[model samples]
Target: MALVKEGDTITIDAHARSLHLHISDEKLAHRRANCQPLPPRYIRGVLVKYTKLVSSSSLSALTDFNLF
Candidate 1:
């Protein structure tokens, strides 16, 4: 999100299953270095628990039972 700015071009290739950001490597590196992590939207309850317990979707969205 931080890497993308207004007027920046983006391409989505469904067939290739890829996304392209039309920005220079230098610009991307600069954006990455300056990017800040977003604060958690949920502070408590099931959502918070879910956030802590769930693994990344790349890992198949498995819950870490050890967190329970």
Candidate 2:
């Protein structure tokens, strides 16, 4: 877990297997104590299809940040 002040943004890997969140720490304790549980919502995932050459060329183009 990471602690950040307002206006800060943190990134986490969604596919990471060994990730853990420690709420007992002082920073997160308040959130754990006050928040109520909510039902999970369903979100549709997007699927992309790319051939070998197409993916390689796309990745090469992506090296230039302005493309996106």
Candidate 3:
């Protein structure tokens, strides 16, 4: 998960929240605590097709952050 974002404090459990927010930890910046559970299926396959894009883009982005 660190590849797309940071902090293990965040979660992707759609069953725990009202809306499925595919968001980052910054969304919790104003919150008191983040107790959201981690759902294994939530947004699971969404990245399958983007895998190659993510890998190559990330590698290219490392040398040129502008690509991100």
User: Which regions in candidate 3 have their CA more than 4 angstroms from the true location?
Assistant: 1-44, 56-68
Give each model's whole-structure lDDT: 0.89, 0.47, 0.45
Best by TM-score: 1
- For each candidate, C-alpha RMSD in Å? 3.4, 12.6, 13.7
TM-score for all models, in order of appearance: 0.71, 0.26, 0.16
Kindly indicate the candidate among 1 and 3 with the higher lDDT: 1
Can you write out model 1's per-residue Cα lDDT over 31-54, one digit (the tens) per residue? Answer: 899999999999999999998888
Model 2 weakest lDDT span, ten residues long: 45-54
Clashing pairs in 2: none
lDDT of 2 at 14: 77
Best by the lDDT measure:
1
lDDT of 1: 0.89
- Report the lDDT of model 3 for residue 39: 57
Misplaced by over 4 Å in model 2 are 1-8, 18-24, 38-68
